[model samples]
Target: MKPTLRAALTSPFVVFTVFMLGKIYLSWFVIFESAFSWLPLLTGLPTVWAAFAPIELFARKRKLMLYMIVNVVFTSVYFAAIMYYKYFGVIVTYHALQQVGQVTEVKGSVFSLLHPYFLFIYTDIVLFGLLLTFRRTFRSWAVRGMTLNRAAAGLIFPLALMVSIFCMWTNRDSINEIKQAQHMGILNYELYAIFAKRSEPLLDESEITAEAIMKAKGLAANPSPNYWRAAEGKNIVVLQLEAFQNFLLGLSVDGQEITPNMNSLMKQNFYFPHIFQMVSQGNTSDAEYMLNTSFYVPPYGAAAQDYGDRALPSLPKEFRGIGYEALTFHTNDVVFWNREELYKALGFTRYYDKSFYGDADTVAFGASDEVLYDKTVTEMARLQGEGKRFYANIISMSGHHPFNLPDRKKKIELPDRFDDTLVGDYLTAQQYADYAIGQFIDKLKETGLWDQTVLFIYGDHMGLPIYSLSSKEHALMKDMLGRDYSYPDMLNIPLIIAGGGVTSPQVFPQIGGHVDFMPTIANLAGISLADHLHFGQDLLNTQHNLLPERYYLPSGSLINDTTIYVPGRGYADGVTYALPTGDGAMPSEDEYKRALELLHMSDSYVNQLPKHD
Candidate 1:
């Protein structure tokens, strides 16, 4: 073979291609499992080459070694994305890249998803290293006269760009990101997401005007509370449960209840079993942002990371306006997801995070819920003694992902069928978290604050990821749910509001999301948010509600009165499921339009908020 041809065959470009192909190949197997398509896999090539061509063309001989290093770095990104998507059901973005530093706290969950097969992407690097070490054996690459000229390498950029752009334009209509990733490949899908986000117009002042607020308020159903503000002047405590889904509320295996405390609480409170979580890329922090600000998460990123700098109009600020002190407590450090800045933007009077909670009783990520509630209640008692009404946002961390708690912390015993399974570990951890919550309630009653306080509890997001299960485990969960696990099942979380002053213990079957919490809670507190530019309506007053699920689900997936609509490639190709049941159906075209309109308005509203310090 000619020296130039042989040299080209052994170039770092070849190694980079091999690494990326392995990445796409391994990711495909991990996601769809045994699903094969050559064209889809081939499409990952042009974009990878396009990204590398410029870097290579501009660098000198000294940077030749750096090429292999860069190849490793880029391949690692896909490795991380594949591992994340296994449990998250969503792809990580460039925005998520900024938050990678925060993964140390949740390394437990990260390591759980990793497998030995994940190392396949690195095999090419090993091969390249071996070739370098044994240069004499590979004469084609080690030949002194085989050098790449700038003119010859210049051809790669145009060839790659043309192919990459063609892929993007052809797949522009692919709205379902999962399908898009499958069809266009990961490299192309990422480029597609970048343009999709950049093309979105910012929300303007007109979108948040008084007239807009009135129009949004008109969409709500008439108020039907037995007595409005029944618990006015009382303390408000909101518990954000980590990964606690609605199915676990009354779930029993072998006659052993999974969440006995919550099951009992649901009977005496307003239980909205149909409420779905609306968190975006931020996950738990997104839940907090939604509940406080009543805004949609940014189209492509976590609201906390994307909008933390803006002065947000929030539940805490509204409570402060009503002569109440507001504070939020979480077990994690304040710097995670830039929460210290986010809390300030949300108008929190004070935030008590990891430093305040200590390491008394630790969990997967931080301090245990047992310690969180204990410390919070102690502070609440101090405020109660001072005759002050407070609004407290408490975030629980015990039921986090990987759901593996020590044996001493576990309370529920699994049957023989569930031994050492993800489902079993989840139940044990959630049950213990519930037990801690039950303990907190008892402490409230013991301190005589139970009757004088109005409390709300909700899961931050879904517990079990649909994609994380083995066939046997999936079958077990399917048998328990009586159907295939789906978007509705994945996003459905328990929302319970209970206290002594909640005179009527009723079940509200209306569909809602995190967006609705601030409005609903405000209405129950005798504070009307009708004048504010909020995305959610009061569930208590609204006869029905429909909210879009952004981030975790497809962009167009939404929860309504009795169904969840998930777009396939786009609104044209989507699936719908009956609420609280996994039964499938064909959603009408009008439903599609409504879902689109809701998403557009939500995006517009958040974009319109004034940028702040």
Candidate 2:
């Protein structure tokens, strides 16, 4: 018998209710197995009712098809949320919508995280469709008269909206975005995203008075006027590496060197062993912006997309002041991630992207590192002959995630333990990356520009995750390090200063971030930034270092000399762990307070500023 109007109202709603709760449980199981927060499951009921409530007006076939469509959309979102959480350790936000350009560069890493098990989310709809399509008896249910169930329909919309309001009120003071997201559930979070518009400003715009600037300067290190800028008039060459972490620096397998070129350069240049990445949503672009401006990245979307129109005060602008032409070179199209506008905001004299180089060698979805360097050096040489002082920013890409390279260029012979493993593939690609960068350095020397140019070589961000490793691999890594490898180790990237007048090698043992890049470079170039609204300190002169973490870690988390403190939900429930050891302990209150202050001030400064036309 065909089901009645009452059956239509109640039947699919029951199935949808199951799908809704099941998906939430699945999302929980994926991220933290055997652990869950039940509130989102409970809170999501109203949304399910709201969804199915509108279905009564349509015929049964249309209703079933529409319900199947809803399942598809939600399944996709929850699956994306699962993948996002696995990689970033945070709930995916609406801001990620703008990051599609990055998918091509990071697909290897992304695809690695995804497994066939994710298909379970859609199984309910698939089974429902199959049952209806194959069974002639079930098809009778599809022709249920197009009738409105006023009693059921009248209640769902109002109840959903009202419950959503209650969830919002309950989560109002939950300022921690992650905590708030968990409490409200997926459907409610999307609603919150719409209403919240943006986060509340951490500080009043009027509070950035002279005293605030004085307080900011007080929190940072006092720089020696010309301690580092002795190479004031030299040309600048900066290498911004992608997914290049410091773990592979001295790593060797089967007695072969992983990075013979960078290893040799660190012996004679200024190498920072403790610099951490501080990029926000912009990632690589954020790194470039921070390296030049000494300013915080926008807390929301990428600065390239959101603040690309602003007249950003940057290193390029500083170079332009002294008759130097500032240029940047990337292997991808200049328009990727809206970088063309970013270059404009940062004031680059010219940008050399894919259009400038021929397609002889391509890797990592773009031109190879070999092409990037050869063309960049050739152009720099021409500019030098033309008597143009230049600041050339070169961004490298070969060592990017999913780190697999062409088999011909795979030089490493991995032990059976690492064969076909993520880390093993990463090492092979990095070896190639090292070889490419080495060629560039050699060419610079061959052209006699090595001594005349000051090169700042540094990593853009962390590439690998400890969670991606198997137990054996993790144990092997621990054995290699002779200790527990944690956040500090994973986030550490190489920062080298070569050919800038120092006769011997030196290593800065202090911790720093990209925020300090311009200040340090400015000091070396004899350009003072004491009067500017800068957040970073010159690491060359500081004895104490404090850096607040963002993006990868929870808000209010910070790193100091001996500890890396990551909060559970907020500052009150935070845990501090010793560096490289992963031993839990209490953090220093004074330094931690200072770090939070810096984060707040930076957020305040950026958010309160007006966007330029």
Query: What value does the lDDT take at residue 576 in candidate 1?
Result: 77
Expressed as tens digits, the lDDT of each residue in 1-613 for candidate 2 is 4567556554655657678788877876765455766666667777666666777544445666777677777777788878887777666777899998777767877888776787788788777779878986655453453444567577776787688678877875653566666667666776687777655557875665435643633454463443566678899888998878887778777688888999988778888888888877777888888898877666666768877877776789888988999999998888877899889888899998888875667787688898888888998999998888888899998787778687766766777877767777777788898999899999998887887898889999877676566566677677666677677777788899889666678888877889878878888788777556777777777655667777676566777666778765556667776764334466656555666667677667766565544
Clashes of each: 3, 3
lDDT value, candidate 2, whole model: 0.75
What CA root-mean-square deviation does each model show from the true structure?
A: 3.4, 3.7
- The lDDT per prediction is 0.79, 0.75
Residue 28 of model 1: what lDDT? 79
Which ranges in model 2 have alpha carbons more than 4 Å from their true place?
1-10, 33-40, 43-46, 53-61, 101-109, 131-167, 201-206, 209-226, 467-473, 580-597, 603-613
Candidate 1 wrongly placed segments (more than 4 Å): 1-20, 32-34, 48-70, 130-157, 194-196, 207-227, 581-584, 588-590, 607-613
Worst 10 residues of 2 by lDDT: 139-148
lDDT of candidate 1 at residue 421, scale 0 to 100:
77
